[model samples]
Target: MVPEPEFRSYYGQPIIKGPLWHEPHMPAYLYLGGLSGASSLLAAGCELTGRDRLAAPAKIAAAAAGTAGAAFLVAELGRPERFLNMLRVFKTTSPMSVGSWILAAQSGLAAVAAGSALTGLLPSIGKAAGLATGITGPMMATYTAVLVADTAVPSWHTGHRELPFLFAGSALASAGAVAMVAAPHREAGPARRMAMVGAAMETVAGEVLERRLGLLAEPYREGSAGRLMRAARVLTVTGGALAAVSGLTRWRTPSVLSAAALTAGSLCVRFGVLRAGRASAADPKYTVVPQRERIDARERNRAHGR
Candidate 1:
C-alpha cells in the first residue's frame, strides 16, 4: 500500500495568508446582504400577489439590511470612497467589481421601494422599483459565495459547487424569518413556507459540502468554527420544524421563537464560514495536501489513458 504523505510548508509558515476581514464587520456585512437580497425578492412576490401587509415589512427589511450591510462593508474597507472607487469601472471578470455594482443597484432599488411604501406617494414608482429588485436580489444574496470561492482558501474554494446554494438558502431563511416575525400570521404563510425550504436547502448543502471535502472540511467541524457550526445546525433545524408548527397553530409563541432561531442561525453560518476559511488558510496542510493528492490522481488518470 502507498504510504500517506506528510504535510508541511517552508519554515512551518502558512502556504497562504489568512484573510484580514475582521469580526462583526465582514461577517455582519455578509449576513445582512443576504437578508436584504432575499427580502427584496419576497417583497416583489408579495407586491405582485397584492399582499400589501407582508410586502411592507419585506420592503422595510430589505432597505434596512442593505443600508446596514453597506455601512459594515464600508467600515471593513476603512474608507467610504474605497467602495465608491469600485464603481468607476465594471470588470466582468472581477467578482468584486460586479458585486459592487449589484450592491449599488439593489440598495438603491430597495430604498426607493421602502420610501414609496412609507410616504404613500408615487405608488407606481415604488412598484416599479420593487419589481426591479427581483432581478438583482438573487445576485446580491449569492455573489459573495462566488467571490470567496474564487480565492485560494481551501475551505471556501473547495466547496464552490455548493456554497452558492448554501448562501442563497441562508439569505432566504433570514428574510423569511424576518417576515414571519414582522407580518401578521395569516399574511405570513408564504414566509413560513420559504423559511422551511431555505432551512432544508442550507442543511443539505452543508452536508454535501462536508462529505465532499475530506481533510479540508476539518476547519468547519473543529475548533471555534466547529462550535458555531454545531449551534447553527441545532438552531436551524429546530427553527425550521417550529416554523411548520407555527403555521399550523398560528400561535405567536412558536412564530417568534422560530424567527429568532432562524435569524441567529443565519448569522452563525456567515461567521463560521469566515472562521473556517481563515483556519484553512493558516494551515499549510490544507493547501499542500489537497494539491499533491490532485496531482497524484491526475498522473494515475494519464497512465490509465496510455
Candidate 2:
C-alpha cells in the first residue's frame, strides 16, 4: 500500500497573488536600464578610440535611459516616497539595496558624461565621467539578475548563478542595437562584437539554468514564460549570427535588422524572466512542498546520525 501525498499551503493560502503592476511597465524598465548601461560602456569605448560622434549620442542615450528607468522603478514601488528607504540601509545580502546604489551611481555618471558631451567645454572631465560610467554600466546591466534571484521566487532564485550572465548578454545586445541605428559602420563594429558576446553568454546561461532547475524549470519551459523564452532564444541567436557576419560584409540593412531583432529579443527575455518569477511565486507547489521536504529530510538525517 502506498501512503497518501501531503498537500501544503503557501502562507496558508492555496494560490499566491500576482504582482500589482502590469508586465509592460516592469519589463520595459528592465530593458531600458540594460540599454542605458550598455550605452554608457559603448560611449566610453568610443571616447577612448577618438570616435567623439559615436560617444556623444551613446552618452545621451545612456543618461536618458538610466534616468527614465530609475523613475519607472521608483514609481513601481508601492510607496514611492519609501523608495529612499532602500538607500537608508545597505545590506550585501539584499540585491535590491545593491541594485539601487548601482543604478544611482550609473545615473549620476551618465548624466555627467552626457552633459560634458553636449557642452564640449569639459572634454577632460567628461572623459573621466564616461570612464566611471563605463565601469559601473556592466554592473547596472547585470545586477537586476541578482535582485530577482534574491527573492523567494523559485524560478529566478534557483537560477541565480546564470541570471547575471543572461542580463549582461541582453544589455550588450541592446547597446549594439542602438549603435547600429545611430553610428557609422567603422564605429559600430565593436558594438557588434559586444552584442555577439552578450548574445552567446545569455543563450548559454539560460540553457544551463533551464537544465539545472528541474521541476522549477517548468515556469520557463511552459505557458507564457515558455513562449517568451523561446522567442528570445531564437531572436538573440539569429540576430547575433547576422551581426557577426555583417562585420565582414558591407551589408548595412542586414546589420540594422539584426540589431532590431536583438533589441526585441532582450525585451522578451526580461518579460519572460519576470513572468517566470511571478509564476514560481504563485504556485504553492513551488514555494511550500519542496522547502518543507528539504527541512524534513534534513531533520531526519540529523536524527539518524544521533
- Candidate that scores best on TM-score: 1
lDDT of all predictions: 0.94, 0.85
Candidate 2: clashing pairs of residues:
none
Instruction: Tell me the alpha-carbon RMSD of every candidate.
Output: 1.2, 2.8
lDDT tens readout by residue for model 1, 37-80: 99999999999999999999999999999999999999999999
Summarize candidate 2's per-residue lDDT along 206-229 as a digit string, tens digits.
899899888888999889999999
Residue 70 local lDDT, model 2:
82
Clashing pairs in 1: none
Best by lDDT: 1
TM, every model = 0.98, 0.89
The lDDT, on a scale of 0 to 1, for candidate 1 is 0.94
